[model samples]
Target: MKRVTSLLILVTMYFSIACQPTLEETNSQLREEVIAVHDEVMPMMGKLKSFEKQAQEKIAKLEQEENVDEARVEELKALAFDLNKAYDGMFVWMRQYEVEDGDKSPEEVESYLKEQLVLVSKVNEDITAALEKAERVIGA
Candidate 1:
């Protein structure tokens, strides 16, 4: 019975040590992660712009072609609009965001960074979806 209890206590202590993150570590990791997400998505804005231009050129060429499908052209236009919106959303968010610093407590900074991670994740999702839709449209 004594051996079993000792083993159990050892295991619990090991797990607890492994599972816990210090507040500073959490803050730093979350901040780096959120910035990485933003960096990953930032280049997509320029790609979106390029896609928009290509789409416009394609639409123009289609218009010159006889028997063009107006509905298809309209769909491309809508996709372009959405892509622009996604790009703008990310740019605006970056412009508006401020870094948490020494003025804030570690807990407050961690909380702020965690919130930013969610926001940046959402922006990344939006940009990815927009890029995928634009690619499909361009391919079609």
Candidate 2:
């Protein structure tokens, strides 16, 4: 009976160890997820650029004319700033991001990847929110 129990315990331990993912695997998966989020929002760059141009044009028009709605001009200025901010955020993230698999330990790599995931996710949110607001502002 004791032998059978020991065998069962060994089998469970073996399976558990075998099924667990390595840190490298975890980091790779995290890297893929981060890139996926970035990719999802990347196409919005062109839209952001277009909206920035439109907003600038509108602001310029409003500024040149007398009795122009100051509030509308201000709103467009803010939106244009946010659009550029989001656009720059993505570029900043891409520029600073690095894959450290050689000098860093697997655990360190995983941690770095996790941090990157959060950063990219925030960038995605910023881009998404800015784009949505821009669309509404322009469409209205």
Candidate 3:
């Protein structure tokens, strides 16, 4: 009975030691992955924040101009519609990253996300131009 008990203890100790490294390795990999994700996501968040600030400034200006040019209202309406469509598309692109981040490999997902940055930047440029044109019309 004593030998059986001792043998059982030794086996348990061996298994525990053998299993520990696998768990630690998995934990370490997950930590690295999380850090990588943060590195990628933080910059994009900053860009989005800057874009939001610019948008807010434009909207404030637009509100100030609302009473100035009653005649340009139709043009403003079209610009607003275009702007909304562009922004909705941008939101969808961002959401796609959120959905695919875990399922796809990081490199593959990031490549696709990079394409979205170009598209979003282009849309932002278009919106900026439209806002500027609208403001000019309002000022006139």
Candidate 4:
């Protein structure tokens, strides 16, 4: 009975291991996901800059107007700051990023890609949030 149980355990372990994705496959998938998130948000940097410019112009115009709302001007300034920070974050990440070479081990590649995935995803979220906030403020 014990021998049978041991054999079953070994077979189960083998099947489980076989079902799991290889490190290279995992790395490739992670790399693709990271790149996808980055590509999705990259073009938004330009849009964010344009919005910032518009907000700055609005603030400037408000400053020169009679009975201008200082609170509104401050809100626009805050929105522009957020947009700038988000845009700069992406640019800096791109500038500092190094492409993984074939010489890297599968484990190393996977680790690096996983880290990048987190970073890219966060940047995407930040940019999206900033854009949404800007739209809300502008629409109001």
Candidate 5:
């Protein structure tokens, strides 16, 4: 009888502890979601930067050459269309995730600002890379 009672107590304690949520688990989940959004959107931002640089280069080439490259302009415009579509799609998912996560609270907002700042920094590096490529392509 004593052994049965002890076993029951042990099982109850194990179940209770297993059901409890840990701070680490919650944080890891949040981090996973944030990383997923970053992964989803960062590439789109890079594509935008690439399109912007390509458009700038085409504009410069059209300016410098005696005859404008209508084909390059059309190509750039097509890239712009694709870039806009990608940005819109990525942003829709991002906003939905943010809303569902309820990250609009002051503290959450502050955290988001910090994370976004880091993301912006990374994107700026990508933009710079695109700009360098554009400069090389345009001989400028």
Candidate 6:
């Protein structure tokens, strides 16, 4: 009876250890989270271009007039630039991003995922802010 109990305990411990998530698994989860954040913001890309176009069209119309509101035109110009910049940031990040483990160590993979999360978060913020600014200027 004693021997059987010990064997059972050893088997249980082994299974428990084996069932735990490895560092690579944890890193894979982190990578998924990074991709999730990216996916959440990607659909807004078209709005960036649309808002930029509106800003440009407004600027053009204002520029053709003799009594142009320079302040408003400048604001629109800045907004347009911001929108385009945010749009470009997404593509740049995507181009630079890599998910393949390659020959990287687990620690290195974790570090890379953490860095990518931060970068994508910043890009997400830029996108949100630019879109909000556009909506405000374009009247909802």
Most TM-score-accurate candidate: 2
What are the candidates' C-alpha RMSDs? 3.9, 1.2, 12.8, 2.4, 8.6, 2.6
> Highest lDDT, which number?
6
- Clash count for each candidate, listed in order shown: 0, 0, 0, 0, 0, 0
For each candidate, the alpha-carbon lDDT, in order, equals 0.87, 0.92, 0.53, 0.88, 0.58, 0.96
Evaluate residue 56 in candidate 1 and report its C-alpha lDDT on the 0 to 100 scale. Answer: 85
Regions more than 4 Å wrong, model 2: none
Give the local distance difference test score of model 5: 0.58
Q: After superposition, how far is residue 125 of candidate 6 from its true place, in Å?
A: 0.4
Stretches of candidate 6 above 4 Å error?
A: 1-20
Deviation of model 4 at 56, angstroms: 0.7
RMSD score of candidate 4 (Å): 2.4
Better of 1 and 2 by lDDT: 2
Report the poorest 10 consecutive residues by lDDT, candidate 2: 99-108
Model 6 backbone overlap count: 0
Estimate TM-scores for all models.
0.77, 0.95, 0.37, 0.84, 0.38, 0.86
Candidate 4: segments with Cα more than 4 A from true spot? 1-15
**Compared to the true structure, candidate 4 yields what TM-score?**
0.84
Candidate 1, residues 1-140, lDDT tens digits: the string is 99999999999999999989988988889889999999898877889898888888878888998899999889978888888888888987898677747699998888888888898899999899988998888862
lDDT of 6 by residue, 23-114 (tens): 98999899999999999999999999999999999999999999999999999999999999999999999999996978999999999999
In model 4, which range of ten residues has the least summed lDDT? 95-104
Q: On residues 11-125, what C-alpha lDDT tens digit does candidate 4 reach at each position?
A: 9999999999998888878888988999999888888988899899999999999999999999999999998999998988887666754688888888788888888888898
Compared with the true structure, the alpha-carbon lDDT of candidate 2 equals 0.92
